[model samples]
Target: MWHLITAPILLPMFTALLIMLPPIHYSPNRRRWVSMVSSAIQLVLVVLLLLQVQQQGQLHYAIGNWQAPFGIILVADTLSVVLVCLTSFLALGAICYGSAGEDEKGSFFHPLFQFQVMGINGAFLTGDLFNLFVFFEVLLIASYALLIHAGGKNKTKAAVHYVVLNLTGSAIFLIALAVLYGTTGTLNIADMAQKVAQLPASDLMLVKSGALMLMIVFALKAAVLPLQFWLPATYASASAPVAALFAVMTKIGVYALLRVYTTIFGSEAGALSGIAADWLLPAGLATIALGAIGVMASQDFRKLVANLVLLSVGTLVSLVALQTQQAAAAALYYTVHSTLVTAALFLIADLIANQRGKAADRLVSGRKVVQPVLLGMMFMVGALSVAGLPPLSGFVGKVMLLQSVTDPDNRLWLWSLVLLSSLVVIVGLSRAGSTLFWRISGSDTVAETAKPLQVFAVCWLLLASPLLVIFAGPLTELSLQAAAQLYDTNTAVQLILGQEVTP
Candidate 1:
C-alpha cells in the first residue's frame, strides 16, 4: 500500500518511454490513444493512492531501500496526496480536451505532457529539498517547451520573458539552498526541520532570509501581486489547454510555501515570531486588491481569467499569513477550489472564443456572445464562484478564512482591508462577467458548434466543482488534518523517532 505513492510518480515516465518506441511513434492516432490510455491509468492510480492515504494515514516509501537522512524518501501525506490527485485530474482533463484539437497531435506534445506530470508528482512526493528543486526544474522545462509549442510570435515573446524571469528566480533559489545546506549540512527536508531550530541566532536569520528568497521565487511562479505582470501576458498568449495546465503549476508554488513555512520554519517559535504576522497580512491584502483591479480593467476574456488566478493566490497567501490551523485549512480548501475553477474557466474561454469565431464567420469581432443563454449561465456560475459568492466552494473557503483571523480586536483595520478587498473582487469579477458573457454580441448564427469532447471535459470539471461546496465538511476536515501535519514536526518525529534519526 505504501508503495502506491511511488506509482503515480513512476507510471508516467514508464509510459513516456513506451510511447517513444519506434512502433508507437509511427502512428499519430496510435500515439494519441497510447497517451490517453496512460493518462487514464495514471489517474486511477492517483485516486487509489489518495484513498489509501486517507484511510491508512501517511505513506512513506524510501527509494532504493535506503532509510531517511541518508537516502531519498517519498512521502504521501494527506497534503501531498491531495495535490497528486489534483495534478492527475487536471492533466487527464487537459489531455482529453487537447486531444480533440489539431495541435494535440504534435510529436512532442504527448511526451512533454507526460514529463510535466512526472515532474509534478515527483515534486509532491519527494521528501528532500534538493530533490524538490530538481523536480521544479523538470516541471518548468517541460512548461517552457509547451508554452512555446505553438511557435507563434506571441508565444515566442511571452516565452522569452517567462524563461528569463523564472531563471532569475531559479538563481535565487539555488543561492538560498546553498546557504541553507551550508548552515544545516543536510538537504533532506525532515532533517533540516529538526536541525533548523538548533541553529544559532545569526544562522537562523540567514535561514529566514533564505526562506524569504525562496518565497519570492515561488511568489513569482504563483503570480502573487507585484510579481504577477508576466503571468497574464504569457497565459493569454498560450493555447487554452496549456493555460489550464499552468493553473496547476501555480499551486505547486503554493504547496511549497505551505510545506516549507509551516513544517520547517513555523516549527521554530523564535523564527516565526521574528517574522510577525502583520507583515505578511498587509502584503497579501495588497495582492488581493491589485489582482481584483487587474481583473476589472482587463478587456480580454483570457486576460480576465489570468487576473483571477492571481486573486486566488492572494487569497491563499493571506490564509497562510494568518498561520492558524483554521486559516491553513481555508487556504487548502481555496487552493482546491481555485485550481478547478480556473481550469474550468480556461476551457470555457476556449469554447467561447471558438464558438464566437464560427458565429461571426471568422471576422474577429471582439467579445461577442454567441450562445447567450449557455454563456450567461456559465459566466454567472464561474464569475460568482471566483468572486466567492455563497453556496459555492469559494464562498465556503472565504467564510472559513474570515472567521479564522483572531486579531480583529487589535487589527480592525486589517480585517476591514480584507473585507474591502473581497468587495473589490466581487465588483471586478462582476464587471468582467457582464462584459464578456452578457453584454457581448448575441449572434447565434456565428457561434460554431464546439467539439463534443472539449465541451464534455469542461462541463464535467465545472460540474464537479460544486461538489466541493456540497462536501465542504469532509474536505475541510482533511485540509485541517493536513495543516496539522504541516505545522507540527511531532508527526514526522514520531514516525521516525524510534528508528534511525541520524543524518
Candidate 2:
C-alpha cells in the first residue's frame, strides 16, 4: 500500500537518474528502453493506487513517517489517484509514440520525458502548496527543453513565449504562497484549510487576495481565453509526441484548480466563497467562443488540435464554476475523455502529415495520402470525440456536465455554448477533414510513412474514449466517488492532520 503511494514519483525519478549515468550515456536506444519500462511500471503502480483508494477510501502517506503540518505528505484520494492513472495512461502511449524516432530528435529527450512524468506525478500527489510549485517548475523546465527539442525557429519563439508567461505565473505563484503562509503560518493545504477560519481579521484581505492570485496562476496554466494566447503556437510548434504528451500538461492546471479550489476553499471560504464564480463562468464561455473561432481559422492540423485543447479547457472550467459535486464528476470524466482523444489527435495529425506527402496536414485541397485509410478513420473518431458527438465518452461526459448544471441561471447559458461550440467544432473539423480527404484529387507524392508502433500507439489512445463509453456506468460512479472525496473537506483535513482518518 505504501509502495503504491510512492512508486509513481520514485520510479520515474530513479529511472531518469539511471538514464543519466555514464554507463548508459552513449545509447539512445537503451535510454528509450529504460524510459518505456519505467513508464509501464508507473502505469501499473498508478492502477494499484487507484484500486487502493477505491478500497480504503482516501489514504495519505507522510514522507519519512513524519506527521502532516511538519513534514511532506503524499495523498491518495480518489481525485489524485484518478489523475495519476490518467497521466500514466497518456505517458505510456506518448512514450511509445515518441519511441518511433521522436525521442531521437533531441539529445536528452528520454531523460527529460522521465522527469516530466515525475513532476506530473508529484504534482498530483503532493499534499502541500510549496511542493506543487517545485513540481510545476520541474515539469516546466523539462517542457521548455522539449518544446524546442528538434530546434525549430518557430518552436524557439514559442518556447520564449511559453517560458516568459510561465515564469511570470511562477513568480506570482510564490507571492500567493507567501501570502497564504504569512496569514496561516502553514504551507500544507489541509492545515491551511483548517486554519483559514481562525485567521485574524487583519489578515483576511491578504488571504482572499492570495486565493484569487492562486486561481490566476492556475488559469494561466489551464490557458483560458485571454491567458490562452501563449498556448496555440507552443503546442503547434512541438514535435508530435511531445505535443501529445502536452495534452495532459495543460490538464494539470485544470486538475489543480479542481482539486485546490474545491478542497481548500469550498463553501466555507468566507470572502473567498464565490471567488471564481463571478468571472470564471463568463471567462470560460469567452474562451470556448474564442477557441471555436481559432479552430475555424486554423490552417493546419496542429493548430486545430491546439485550439481544441483550449476549447476543451473552456468547457471544463465553465462547468466547474457551477460549484457542484455533479459538475466535478462530469469534469473528471471529461478530463479523461479529452486527454486521451487529444493525444490521439496530435499523433494522428503527425501520422497524417507523414502520409499526405506534399499535402502535409494543411487544411487545403491537395494530393491524397498513401494508405491513410486507417489514419483517416482514426482522425474522424478523434474529431467526433473532440466535438462531443454521440455514443463516445466525450458525448457522455458533456451530457453529464449538462445534467449537472440544470439550474435556471447556468442551464441556458451553458447549454447554448456547449451545443453551439460543439457545432462549430464539428463544422471546422468537417471542413478540415473534407479538404484533406475528399477534396484532394491526386495520388500521393512524397510517400512519407508512419511506423507500425506509432500507429498502434495512436490507436491505443483513440480506443480509450470509446472504452469509457463501454464502462461509463462504473467510471461515472468512480468519478462521483472521487468528487465526493474532494468535497468532503473534513475527511481530508483530518486525514492530513494525522487525526484518525475517516473511511
Candidate 3:
C-alpha cells in the first residue's frame, strides 16, 4: 500500500492518456464519464493516502529505487497529502460541473483537466525542487489551454497575459534552481536543507539570492502585491470550471513558500534563517489593501470574486509569515476554506451569468433569474462566507487566524487589515448581490434554467462552508498536526535522507 503514494501522480496521467485515445476523445459523453470516474477514483485514493499519512507519519517513494539527493523522490507528509486531497476534491467538483456541456466546448478538455490534476498532485508530493518546477510547467501548460477552452475574445486576451507572465515566472524558477543547485550541489530539498546549514561564507550570498528569487516566483504565483495584476483578468475571463480549478493554482505558490522556506532556510541555517520573513508581512498587508480596493471597484461579479482570491492570498501569506505553528495551522485552515468558497462563487457567477441574458454577471440590473431564490441564497452564502462572516467556515478560519497572532504589533496589523478588508469585501459583495438579484429589469425573456449537474456541483462545493464549520474539530486538528510536521524540519530532513526518525 506504500506504493499508493505514487497513485495520485500516476492515476491522472494514465487517465489523461486514456482520454486522448480515439473513442473517448471523439465522444463527449464518453470523455466526460471517463474524466468524472477518474476524478472520483483519485479523490478516493487521496483520502486513503491522507488516512495512511495520519496513521503512518510520512510516506516516501524513490523513483527507480534511487534515494533522495540522487534520483527523484516523492514524500507524502501530512501537509503535502492534505493539499493533494484538497486538489482532488476541488478537481472532482470542477469536472462534474464541466460535464454539463462545458467540456464539449473545446478539444481535449478532459485530457487537459487530467493532466492539470496530475501536475497539481505531483507538485504537492515531490521532494525535489527541480521536480516541483517540472510540475509547475505541466500545470501551467494545461492551464494555458484550459483558460481559453471556450475560446472567447476576453479569454484569449486573459490567456495571453497569463501565458506570458507565467513563462517569465518559469524562467525565474529555472534560474533559481540553477543557482540553488550550484550553491548546494543538490536539488533534493532535504539534502539542500542539510547543505544550506554547512555552506561557506562566500556561497552564502549566492544562496540567499537564489532563495529570494524563489520567493519572487512564489509571490507572483500567490498574486502578492505588484506581481498580482495577472490574476484578476485571467481568473475573471476563464470558463467557470476552469476558473474554479485555477483557485488551487495560486495555493501552489503558497505551498512552495511554506515548504521551501521552513525547510531549507529554516532557523538551523545560519545567517540565512527566515530569509523571506521580513518581506512577507509588509507584502501581505499591501496585497490585502489592494485586493479589498479591487473588490470594491470591480464592475463584473466574476472579477470581484477574482479579487477575493487575492484577498485570501494576502490573508494566507500574512498568517504564514508569522512563522508560528499556530499561524501555520490557521493558514492551512483558511487555505481550505478560501479555496472552496472562491471556487463555489465562480461557479455561482457562471450560473447567474447564464440567467441574466446580456447583462451577464456585469453587476448591473438585469432580467430576473429563472431561479432567483436558489441563486440568491447561494450568492448570499458565498458572499457572507467570503467576507468572513460568523457561523461559517470562513469565519472560523479568520477567527483562528486572528487568535493565532499573539504579538501586539502583529495583532494590530493583522486584525486591522483583515477586519477592514473583510468590511470592504462585504460592502462590495452586498452591492453585487443586490444589483444582481434585487435591482432586476422587467424583461420578458429569462435564461435557460441551470442544469441539474451544474447545480449539483455548485451545491457540493458550497456545502464545504457549513461542513467545515461542523467538522472544524477534526479538520483543525489535522491542520495543526500538519503544521507541526512542517515545522519539524530536522525530522523531515532525516526521514528524507533515509534515517530512522525516533519518537
Candidate 4:
C-alpha cells in the first residue's frame, strides 16, 4: 500500500514509454487507448491514495529504502494527494478530448501528453525541493513541445516567449536552491524546515534572500501581476486541451507557496514568519486589476479565457495570503473551482471558434454555431461560473473567501477587488456571449459540428462545478483538514523526519 505513493508518478511515465514503443507508436488508436486507460488508472490510484491519507495520517515512501534527508522521499498528505487527484482527473478530460482528433495534429502527441501528466504528478508528490525542480523541468519541456504542436507562426512566437521566461525562472530557481542548500545543508523540504528553524543569526539574511528568490520563481509561474505579461498570448495560442491542462500548471505555483511557507516559515520561524503574505496580497490585488482589464480588452475568446485564468490566480493567492485555516480552506476550494472552470472555458472557446467559421473566436458578430442551443447553454454555465454567480462552485468559493477574512484592512482590499473584478468579468463575458451567439451576421453557414468526444470532454470538466456545489460540505471539510495539516508543522516534521524536530 505504501508503494501507491509513487504510482501517480510512475504510471504515466511508463505509459509514455509504452506509447513510444513499436506497436502503440504506429497505431493512433492504440496510443489513444493506452493514454486514456493510463490516465483513468492514475486518477483511481490518486483517489485511493486520498482515501488512505484520510484513514492514516501523512504517508511517506523512501525510495531505495533510504530515509529523509539522506535519499529520495515521496510524501502524501491531504493537500498533496488532493492536488495529485485533480491533476489526473483533469488530464483524463484533456487526453479524451485530444483522442477525438487533435492528437493527430502532431507526432508523439500521446507520448508528450502522458509525459506532461507524469511531470505534474511528480511535482505534486515529491518531497524534495530538488526533485520538484526536476519535475518542473520535465513538465516545462513537455509543454514546450506541446505548445508548438501543429506549429503555427503565432504559436511559435508564443512558445519562444514562454520558453525564454521560464528558462530565466529556472535559472533563478537553481540559484535559490544552491543558496538554500549551502545555508541549510539539506534540500529535503521537511529536513529544511528543521534546519531553517535553528539557523544562525549571521546566515539569516542569506536564507531570507534564498526564500524570497524562490517566491519570485513561484510568482512567475503563478503569473502574478508584473511577471504575467507572457501568459495571455501564450495560453491563447495553444490548442484547447493543452491550454486546459495548463490551468493546473499555474496552480502549482500557488501550491508550492502554500506548502513551503506554512511548513517551513510559519509563525515558528522567528523573524521570517509569513514572509510571503505581505508581498503576495498586494501583488494578488494588482493581478486582479490587471486581469480585469485584460478580460474587457480582449478581442479573442481564447485570450479572454486566458485573462480569466489570471483573475483566478489573483483570487487564490489573496486567499492564501490570509493564512488562516478558513482562508486556506477557501483557497483550496477556490483552486479546484477556478482550475476546472477556466479549463472548461478554454475548451468551450475552442468549440465556439471551430463553429464560427472565418470569424473564429474573435469578439465580432458572425454566423451562429450550428448547435447554438447546446454550445450556448454550455457557454452560459461556464460564463456564470466564471463571473462567480450563484448555483455554481465559483460562487461558493467566493463566498467562502469573503467570509474567511477578518481583518478590516484585508476585508476592504479583498472584498473590493474581488467583487469589482468579478463585475468586470461578468460584463466582459456578457459582451462576448452576445457577440458570439446573439449578434449574428454574414452567411448563415456554420462550421462543421463539434466532435461528440470533444463535447463530452467539455461536459465532463464543467460537471464539476455543480457537483462541487452539491458536495460542498464534505469537500470543504476536507479542505479545512488539509489546511489544518499544513499549519501543524510539528506533526509534519515528525512524520516526515521520523524523529522529534522542534518547530
What's the count of clashing pairs in each model shown?
4, 0, 0, 0
As for model 4, its CA RMSD to the true structure in angstroms is 0.9
Model 1: residues >4 Å from true position, as ranges?
269-279, 358-370, 409-418, 437-447, 496-503
Candidate 3 lands at a TM-score of: 0.98
Per-residue error at 304 for model 3, in Å?
Answer: 0.3
- Candidate 2 lDDT, 1-503, residue by residue in tens: 66679898889889989999977767877887888888988898889888888888888888888888988888889888888899999988999989889888787888888889989989999999999999999999999898999897999999999999999999999999999988889988888777775667888899989988998999999998789999999999999989998999888888888777776776756656667777679888999899989999999989999999999999888877888999999999999999899889999888878777676888977777776587779888998898899878789998998899968978988899989999999999999888877877676486757787798889889889889999999999998998898888887887778553221
* Model 2 Cα RMSD, 1 decimal: 1.9
Taken over the whole model, the C-alpha lDDT of each candidate is 0.76, 0.87, 0.91, 0.91
- State the lDDT of candidate 3 residue by residue for 417-472, as single tens digits: 99999899989999999899888887748468889899889988989999999999
Candidate 3 least-lDDT 10 residues: 494-503
For model 4, how does the per-residue alpha-carbon lDDT over 305-420 read when each residue is reduced to its tens digit? 99999998988888878878899889998998999889989999998998888999999988878898999999999999889999999899999999999999999999999999
Measured by TM-score, the strongest candidate is: 4
Writing each residue's lDDT as its tens digit, candidate 1 over 1-503 gives 66787888788888778778889877677777888888889889888987887788777788898877778888888889888888888877787787786445344777888888999899988888888888989889988988987678989999999999999988988998998888888877777767776777878777777778777877777777678789888887777778888888888877787777776667453554425355556666777778777776776778778878887777777777777787888787778888888887887887777766533211224446657677667767776777778877778877777777777662464466556766876776666555555454534454566677686668766765688888887888898898877766666745642332232
TM-scores for every predicted model:
0.92, 0.97, 0.98, 0.99
